[model samples]
Target: MGRRKSQRKNVAMLDSDEDNSSVSSSSTARSDLMSVSGAGDVQVDKDSLLEQALDALYEKRGSTREKALAAIIEAFNTNLRHQFVEKKFATLLHQCLNSIKKGSSKEIALGCHAIGLLALTVGSGDHAREILEESVAPISHALKSSSDSLKTVSLLECLAVVTFVSATETEETERSMQIMWQLLHPKLGSNVVAVKTPAVVVTAVVSTWAFLLTTMDGCSLNSKDWQESISYFSTLLDKDERSVRISAGEALAVIFETGIEKLAAENKTTPDGSILEGNKYRQGYTHILGLKSKILNQVRSLSAEAGGKGSTKKDLNSQRNLFKDVLEFLEDGYIPDISMKIGGNSLHMSTWSELIQLNFLKHFLGGGFVKHMQDNELLHDVFGFTPKRKNILGVEHQMTSGEKRMFQSPNSVLNKARTQFLNKQRMLSKDRNVGHFAFGMGDEDSR
Candidate 1:
């Protein structure tokens, strides 16, 4: 009876486990179906979704318009563009133009931004050229009549974007480039460098120039304009925006590929430095190499770019700094000799920069700012180097005793004070304890 009861219990446990497993499997299957169903629901027709977004975009509230614009971008991303573009781009372009004409500054900016994405997607086709041709009137009007700098910036951005469309007709690039120059003529000629223009506008202009160069790959048929553009961009190396500097660099790079490459290769060089002293570039390319060198060095430098993100005054990294050569220039012009080995009896001495560095370090360590520091004795090792007193370059340097007191002194004031104390102690020792005795010591003033 007991054995039969145990078997019945085991069989009941197996039946319960099977029931739980079946229930879990059904739940898992239902969840998978629901997830798939949710994705399919999201993958609705792009046209209907875009039309809905357009309606939402045209709502009265700016907040609603923002969401609608965002939704349109999302739809564009999902639709693979060319397919959906063929279907609804005409409608989308019409909406954007209407928005630019009738919408607020914010709406206009979004519309212009959307056009950039659309241009990038349909890079080379009649679609791009058509949009570029059609935008000239409204954009030109906006540029002239819009009191809002933001709106002007938007129109400029849109024009810049439209030019990326790779027009498929003869002389289209030339016409596009000329129209762009006219539109940007005012801002590009300003004396304030880049301070007057927004960073986005500068970026747009620069990238547009680069795009122009990219489309026209030849012996730079318009070398004069290219030179003027290159010169203008060279001034932007010191702009307050990293993106602008980057854009300028990119534009210059495009020009370099087109025109300036051969000139840089023909410069004279000295063995000691990498920089070429004589810039022999023709009038068109004179400043290009200098600017190019700066740009190349700027990117690799660890120095914080002005107005760059999270930068502070202490973010300087000078290990590979190219402009450190400027210091050499200063030294050569002002310094008679480096004094790397000043000598009294043919002994080596400190370099001039080394002495300055030492004095500065001593002052820094002894300053009140470091008064609360701990373990400062570690800095004592810096004083271990002994500099000799001798004239450099075989020229005798004239110095008054007071002047000599300043530079010829040991670099550390603490070491000077310690030496005086030790000398006084030794003198006192000789005077005080010749015959005196201590409790268990040989003399009362022994070391």
Candidate 2:
């Protein structure tokens, strides 16, 4: 009876069958799993399970493929699985790609997410570049063919993350951003009718685009191409959906912070594809400056916006705070210096780019955020965070903040999974303020 109970509990923790879009494990459930699997054999048991899941990916049944993919995602999320990735990265990546090619919607979603996690786990190297090179074509194909909202969201996120980590060139990032934008504003030929994108999907595309935008040099982007982007996002400010507005607001923040003067000077092309020189170039700069002024006014209004008929207090607060920061950036040329308390030390994000990357990865990693931030070397480099060092007297040394968070007691499973899981739930269920790291906002001068 106890074994069956454990099995049931594991299923509940790993399988979000009802949602089919999320795979999360509770630390308590993981602790239960550790007890049943035996503490000493945890690594061995997890390896066996991963091997089984990888093989199961080849089974002909769609449900079987989906379950296998889910199990792989859960395993990857629960731990870094560095050894498994090092040995079988190629095989694992190919199987996930095959699932994207042949499996059902859920399978495709899982495969996209699994490949993303794989890229992140591999970090920035030849392996990460390989994941980007191999996965982009299949992900692009899946996006064009499938209209499933859940699948589209996953594909967009995977594209953003893979490109962010692996694409080393400015052109590569631009290409990925173009693909994401196509979902929202497809080029309609003759009889091609545009598909009305769901508000949720719009939110994902805009936010993911902004995430990749953080990586590019503003001067490298074509002025003619991006000139209208500010206007487009300005229109999004009037969107009824709070999420969409929030995403547009964030995107605007990134755009304004990217140094528009440099972008304006890059404007050489006219709308007719002819080169702009002398007066035309100067006109382009002035036009961009005008757009900046218009946006500043819009942001000022949003910062002081009062609650409407059905606006929840929490969401209203989020919008007000975000816009206030944006307004401050526009007027005074000051970005918000936000600090998040992680254990004993605090993680600081003083730039728009840093904050966007942090929020995207926090959502992408979900419960695994704390674990990866603690152990993932790439993240450490990205955030410039250094974990506490241990001395030669390691046996007598006390545990660091990350270790204590992971293991409440010796021989016990990590506890951060539970805390981060609740935080993720709150983030998804309600647009609550950023938490878990005790995220708070402050002024640059104050810092």
Candidate 3:
């Protein structure tokens, strides 16, 4: 019985020794594969091998799993730095992103790490755009994954790349804008990771929107789609997240700046007519004029209500920064040019003059008033009227009794007097021309 037990023990020892030797041999082989390097080789094959090893580790346990992850990350970093001229490197990146899409939780995490590395290397080029579109599905899926850290960090990195590369093209800009809209819209519900991601993604979206709005050419601002987007962003400003509030504020500024010209244009005409005879234009103008005040008021109220707890200063600063863009647009000739009609009629000059005076634009050299004057040469274009370069300085010192009464009267009475003056001027010019012709005919008969 003792001899039989010894034989069994010897067999167990031999099995244990073989197992140890196999593990050591496997570790050494993995180490050699990881360490292999070549000159002028962008390490594309290395990344693929590392990815395969990581896939294997998904089913692995204990120390093998840690080594697998380390190898994958190291390989990704090396390939990310590889020259763009190398086709193999690009293929490897695409492969890695794809693998992440198909990976489980652990694999997905490593994939996000790879994504971050790729983002740092990709430039604003066609290659970058292709990669971005290809990775969008995967990154979006990851965003909805239950892993908060992986989703948040990976989506943030992806957003940065998309925004940076697509800032100049309208189609690209619009596509990215749609994605951002989806991310921010409250009705889309919440992603698994968004609840904990703060508003980094929101900030990136706002920044990208602003950049595109400011840079794109011939971009229309009156689309209902943009209005809905602005509404979504506005709602985010009221979110419990401070980052979201600030980001929303910045985005509002961008929209207002880019859309201000369109708003002013809309305010210059009515749907049924070519002029502002209706109050629709006025109402639209009033709404736009109130936006700044509303935003400022919100900032003040939030500061007061928060009682030193929230990020009141950051919010205020963002509002102020955004307001600067609006002010710049206003200073630029974005205000409505109310002095002239599309068909060249200025019978409404009084109304336009009043608007200019009210807006304090007449005193400025460049604004809506200046733009109108320059565009139509309004001073020289009116029928039967020409403005003197110099006003009649001595005559204006005298005032009629009616004129004195007008000075003391209300605006309505003053307007009525101005209308009467225009009517009388028109009639007198007609009478003077008729009398001159009659006098000339009588003189010819006497001769």
Among the numbered candidates, top lDDT falls to 2
Candidate 1, 271-354: lDDT as tens digits: 343667544334334544334444445444423333346644342322112123222211121111222211221111122222
- List candidate 1 segments past 4 Å from native: 1-44, 56-64, 81-83, 120-123, 144-154, 169-171, 174-184, 187-195, 218-220, 261-447
For residue 397, model 2's alpha carbon misses the true position, in angstroms, by 9.4
Candidate 3, residue 135: how far the Cα is off, in Å: 2.2
Which has the higher lDDT value, candidate number 2 or candidate number 3?
2
Which lDDT tens digits does candidate 3 get at residues 242-317?
A: 6566555555544543454455556676666577755755665554454444454554444344324555776655
Worst 10 residues of 2 by lDDT: 1-10
Q: Which residue pairs clash within candidate 3?
A: none
Q: Identify the candidate with maximal TM-score.
A: 2
> How far off is model 3, as Cα RMSD?
31.1
Q: State the number of backbone clashes in model 1.
A: 0
For model 2 the TM-score comes to: 0.77
Backbone collisions counted per model: 0, 0, 0
Q: Which ranges in model 2 have alpha carbons more than 4 Å from their true place?
A: 1-43, 264-278, 389-447
Model 3, C-alpha of 168: deviation from truth (Å): 6.3
- Please list the C-alpha lDDT of all candidates, in the order they appear: 0.45, 0.69, 0.41
TM-score of each: 0.47, 0.77, 0.46
The order by descending TM-score is 2, 1, 3
Count backbone clashes in candidate 2.
0
TM-score, structure 3 vs. true: 0.46
